[model samples]
Target: MEKQKELVFITVIGQDRKGVVASISGYLYRKDVNIVDINQRIMTDGYFVMSMAVDAKAATVSMTEMSRELDQVGRELGMQVQIQHENVFRMMHRI
Candidate 1:
């Protein structure tokens, strides 16, 4: 059998507030996405930024579907959320 792998890079940015991490993480957990790495911090201007890498090997969700749901989460929290494939992210980040 061929191996199927789905990796995504998710970024959430906005003002600092409670439940930001919880809400996003909860959604990932509910979708059976294994979180590989998470980095969150508060900027000097007090804005919150979060970056997460998730493995969707066992998820029953597609990238577009996941993005749509996450968009709702972002709207609810007044944050700007971005979801992209790992390869595209890496390419953009690489030197």
Candidate 2:
């Protein structure tokens, strides 16, 4: 049987700027995290918002470690980044 994927949702929000996607994706690539899907857009107010579905089962670091490192990356980019397990994200969004 195939191994189950450990999916997580990563959300980034902040002022629009260059290199945001490159920076985030580069970090993930270096960490061995696979991005399954991604969506990003600029809001009317000019804020940048991005959401990514990533498979972290093969990642070299734990989710907590990834979160901490991403937090630092966010700070450097002047943005806010958050990562949540897919199930937890779904649960929190459920009515």
Candidate 3:
């Protein structure tokens, strides 16, 4: 039997810069959060946007803690980072 994976969608938006993916991916790796999917791009205005779906069931850190830490990371990168449960994300984006 397999436990259902807990997933969260993480989104980051801000000015384009170096190490954005590296830093976030590194942190998630260390926390045992598995990134299931990721999409990123630089808009015409030069702003960066990254969105990732992660399996967090095996994570050593709680979602609240991850959110706080990610918020700090976003501050350092001058970006806005947001995390939400997969179900919630789907609901919000649904037609």
Best by lDDT: 2
Candidate 3 ranges with C-alpha deviation above 4 Å: 44-46
Question: Candidate 1 regions off by >4 Å?
Answer: none
Quick one: ranking by lDDT, best first? 2, 3, 1
TM-scores of all predicted structures: 0.88, 0.88, 0.88
Error of 3 at 72 (Å): 1.0
**What tens digits encode model 2's per-residue C-alpha lDDT throughout 43-78?**
898888999999998899899999999999999999
Error of 1 at 69 (Å): 0.4
lDDT of the candidates, in the order given? 0.90, 0.93, 0.92
**Worst 10-residue lDDT window, candidate 3:** 86-95
Tens-digit per-residue lDDT, 31-70, candidate 3: 9999999999988888789999999988999999999999
For residues 1-95, write the lDDT of model 1, one tens digit per residue: 75477778899999989999899999999998889999999989888999999988777788889999999999999999999888986788896
